[model samples]
Target: MVKLKIGILGFGYWGKKIYQALRRIPECEITVVCDKRKIPLDNKKIILTDNYKDLLRMNLDGIIIATPNETHFSLAFQFLLKGYNLFVEKPLATSFKEAEKLINLAAKRNLNLFTGHILLYHPLIDTIKKILENKKNLELKIKRTNKVSQINKSEKEIIYDLFPHDIALLLYFFKKEPKIKEIALEKSLVEAHFLIDNEIKISGVWGKGTDKERTITFFVENKKIVFDGLLSVLKLKENGNEKIIKSIDYQLPLSWELSYFLNSLKNKRIKEKIPTLKVMAVLDKIEKLL
Candidate 1:
């Protein structure tokens, strides 16, 4: 099988992780990496570039945009017009209108577009989904927090950063719009209580300056599934019987996501694998409520 030559834009926080995952996938070859800083390259196979423009002229099958949230629109638009398949981190665009345009452009250009909702590909999530496949009702609760000594963004923007994972999970499980009932919002923290499809109740918390925590729990019909955000462990309890469902097998989510992205590009149907627009639409609605 031929490897897909892909260029990556942004070698910062998430970008570095994506780069590592790309190297692990035999189906992908990193042809170029672009960032403002002169990022060190360990592999001679990669052509490191500080200018993103160089990527436009390179022979590439796809481009992954792992840059900051604000740059997603302009950078993604640049590559989509160049006929490259695209992958972007969560919150694909800051706003719904911009996301809509990108999705439409991908459709018009016959290119594949994927968003980095890595949690969607996680094994714990997969286990929970299979467990809940037969259940009639669902309730969702997500808690995502981090401790930051310095303020990097506004409260609302922080909310944007932390909630995309939870929002993507909601869209996958409930497939309904969530309505916010109350929000205890502050510059350093955010909490929201909402309902999905008027049936599934969800309570969410996002804040910094605390012990780092990320956990999502589901409750229904005397059964509870708990996912440890940091550990990627799953616990299931039923009728007062507690059973640890699985050991943390430790599959890198980044690798799985890249494989899915590459397969979607090869198959020419991203909708069948991961529908990013729906996730973006859910994100947009959640942002408007705040």
Candidate 2:
């Protein structure tokens, strides 16, 4: 098997997770890792550098950008210009214009551009989509919370840090952009209400609290399906009876997501364009509203 030479930028919280997941993929050869700070790695075969430019010269098959949100555009632009395929962490860019430019550049160069919307790769998403298909008068309520102290200091505001996952799921489930009905922001919390297809209603709450929590609930007709992300379980409720419908397999979502990216590179075909422009557009609207 020919290993794909992959380079990653950023070695912080999420970046480290990407590295760990990539290590599990047999076809991924993580050639170089770049971070501005000193990152200690036990593996001597992998090159570690504080300067990202070192990666530009490695002739890598792809580069993963897990840097700060503000730096996503600049770093991705440089890598795409070098003709390397890119997998940028979510929110693709801070602004719609920047995100569009990156997409256009990748399309022009005939290189794959992927975003790290990890939740979409979760096994439960498929089950949820199947259960909600052809359903009417649906309502989605998602709440994501992180413990205040556990939250990464480098992360942006609540909306930018947590809302992309919710918005991406909304687009995936509805297959269209939702019309923003209202937005409310507080010191540690942000909430938004959306109307999908002028019928299905969506509400999202993101905030920092004492404990980590991630839950998504779908109300379709009279049946209710809820996904408890922390527990990796799905439950169904109907006729006053609730039962666990599905418990996800042992594989982590990050591992699955990275595997998909590497396999797509090997096959030279991408299954879906995640972190789509529509996702960025909704984020733009939310940022402006806030």
Candidate 3:
């Protein structure tokens, strides 16, 4: 088996997860890593650098940009231009222009490019999608809240940091862009409400300076599926009886995503794996809302 050389940038919360997960894959080798601050690594063979350009110089099979929202386009652009396969974290680009440009550029160069919409790869979500495909009169409601963290310091609002996960999963399930018919923005507070498809509602709040709650509820006929994001479990109710599902604590999904990207890279067919242009357009609208 040919091991692909993988380089990771950003080295923050999600970055570290990607780095650690990729390191365990037998078909993968962490060639280099970069971040704004010094971070310890399990393997000394992994070259750590503050300047991304330096790591970019190392001959690698792929590069994963888990950096800030602002630097996504530039770094990915340079790497893609050099014909390196890319695995970018969610909200592929902060702007539509950049997202569209990168999507097209990856196609023109025939390079593997995947957006890290991790939720879409979850086993429960996959099950939910399959169930939805066979059910009618299904109503989905999702609510998520994050703990008080410095990550939301982007000054972009909770929607940018939080909504993309739900939005991408919503689009993945709907398999088409739903018209965001109603939007209710709360003022003088830390929470906002949005109504998409006129049936589903998403309300969120952060920066409360206290404990947080993250949950998502899906209503289909007589069954209710509630997802506890913080606890990583699913609560199900049927005929007045309820059951709880505990999520497996593992990095299998992330590994699966990376493996898919590697296969796409070898097959030279990653452009199709990206969110459709229409989905990108809808996300652009939500980006503006943020």
Candidate 4:
């Protein structure tokens, strides 16, 4: 059996998770890993280096960039130019222009360019999306709160760091571009209101607090559906009664996301291209608003 040679850049918190997921795929061979700091690994066959350019020499089938947001554009661009498939951790790029360039170049070379929007691959999210389809007059409220220490670890501002997940979810759920009707920032907290397709309303709040919370609430007429990331469960409430709709299994979203990327590479197709671009464009608008 042939194995796909994969090189991963950055071995930080998220990078390590990507490595763990890629390891479980039978068809994937992690050829090289790059990081600024030394990473101790038990596998002697996998190449570990501190420089990313070394990955270029390995003739990798795909390169996953889990580096800082600022480096995503440059590293992905270089790898795409070399005609390797890419799996970039989301926001794809810091700006829409950079994201568009990478996408266009990948299309020109007939390579797969995937963004790691992990939430889209979540089992609970898929279940929620199916329940909300064809429903009108819906309202979405997502509050993503993190500890100050956790927030400090990110190189991006509060908006850039936390807003993309909810925004990506909105785009996926509504299947329409949103208009930023209002935005306000106070210290580390960011609050924004969006109108989607002139029918649905989205209110998003993200920032640093003492506690960490990841909750998504949907109001469809009199029914309410909520997905709690921390608990990995989905619930529905109506007429003052609530019930559990679904509980996710042990499978992690990162594993699902990596599997999708590998499958796309095997099939030689770029799936989710349009939705990824739409998320980037919305992020660009949000950047301009700030």
Candidate 5:
């Protein structure tokens, strides 16, 4: 078996999880781990570096950019130029232009570039997509929150940090980009209401809260299904009866997403354009509402 030599940038929160997931795959080997802050690795086999340029010189098949939002475009562009398949953490880039450039690079070189939209890999989201495929009656409500307002200090606006996960799911189930009906913005919080194909209502709130809640709810024809991260279970309702998809799987979503990207890298067919630009475009519109 040919092990893929993988380099990961950013050893922060999600970056650490990516490291753990990649280690579980027998076909993967962590070539180097880079971050602004020094990170201690238990595996002495993996080289740790603070300078990302050091990674460019390493022999690696692909690099995963798990850095901050503002740094995503530059880091991804750099590695892509060096001829490595890229797994970029979500919200692709801060702007549509940056996203377009990355996509174009991938197209020109035939290298695979994947956005880290972990929610799309959720089994619950997959089941929901099948149930709501092209259905205009569905209503989506998503909220991603922190316990306090001052906690997050990343360069990304709270909306960009959180909403892409929900938006990816929205685009999948609705099969179209929903029009923004209204947007309410604050310094660190945002509420955007969207109408999908002039039918479904999808509303999202991304920001801090006095209480913590990360939930996605879908309503259709007197029935609703909710995947609640807070409760760690999926709730379903229909015909006056209720069912629970008790205790979501323990497997890491990043692992599944990486596995898919690695396997799909060999297939040359481009079914549709990468959705990074679209995600950035929607984010742009939401930012304008601020």
Candidate 6:
């Protein structure tokens, strides 16, 4: 079998993880890597460029975009229009219109378009979802806070950048859009709070002079499962008794997601994968409320 040549755009914080994972995949070869600014060389094998158009000249099977939220639509548009398979980072795009455009284009081209919703690949999260399925009723609370960034961003709120993970997870586990009964939002240039789904509430703060604190809690019939994201541990409680659930110390999520994508590309159609149009539609609704 011929190995698929993979090109990654935006070799920034999260992109490096996906780049590393692509290197590890035996079926895919990391032929090109591009970033807007100069990045230090991680491996000599990676052909680095500042311009993404340079990548199109090379024979490429797929492209992964880990750039800023705003660039997702335009960059993906360029590549998917050329008929290359794509792995786009979360939220699909900054808006529902762009997401739908990308989806429709990918479908028309009969190419794979996978979202980088890495949480969907987390085994521990999947376990929690299974446990919640057996319960009668539940409410979820997701708290995500991080220290302020030195970099300036246009989409300068936590809701747009961070809450997508929670939104994607809620849609995945609940399997339907819950009536967003009410929303309480406190907005600033950097931070925001969104209380969504009458039962499920999410509080988010992202800006300067803050330490990282991420926690997700699920409350249900006689049970509670709290996810401490920073610590990467889950605390489980049943009937008011609490115990910590150990997460399987695993490799990075992008690697798992890429591996899954590889298998899906080989064995299943792109539409069959998680975070398909169905999932993106739910995200569109959540984006509106955000």
Name the candidate that leads on TM-score: 4
- The residue-by-residue lDDT of candidate 4 on 194-288, one tens digit each, is 99778898897788767899999999778889999888899999989999988875458889889989989889986782477888788788878
> How far in Å is the alpha carbon of 195 misplaced in model 3?
6.8
Worst 10 residues of 5 by lDDT: 265-274
List where candidate 4 sits over 4 angstroms from the true fold: 153-156, 239-241
**Model 2, 151-238: lDDT tens per residue?**
5432245655688888888889878888899988775777779998877988977886667889999987788889998888999999
Model 3 RMSD in angstroms: 2.9
Please, what is the TM-score per model? Answer: 0.91, 0.92, 0.87, 0.94, 0.91, 0.85
List the candidate 5 regions with Cα displacement exceeding 4 Å: 149-156, 230-232, 238-242, 266-274
lDDT by residue (tens digit), candidate 5, 19-81: 888888888888899988979787889999999999888888778899888898998888888
How many backbone clashes can be found in candidate 5?
0
User: How well is each residue in 175-247 modelled by candidate 1, as lDDT tens digits?
Assistant: 6656778877676777888786666788977877466888888897878888886887888879889888875
The TM-score of candidate 6 is 0.85
Per-residue lDDT of model 6, residues 1-290, tens digit only: 67877888988988887876787878988888899888787788879899999977777877888998888899899898888888888757876778889989988988888888777887778778877774554666666655555443333344457766776776777666545444444432333334434444444444333456677888766577898766667898897688988665555566788887777667646543345555556545545664
Looking at model 2, the pairs that clash are: none
Q: Write the per-residue lDDT of candidate 3 for residues 106-179, one digit (tens) a residue.
A: 88997878888777666777766776775555566655554455334443445445666776776777755566
State model 6's lDDT: 0.71
Error of 5 at 217 (Å): 1.3
Give residue 190's lDDT in candidate 5 (0 to 100).
Answer: 74
Candidate 4 residue-wise lDDT at 186: 69
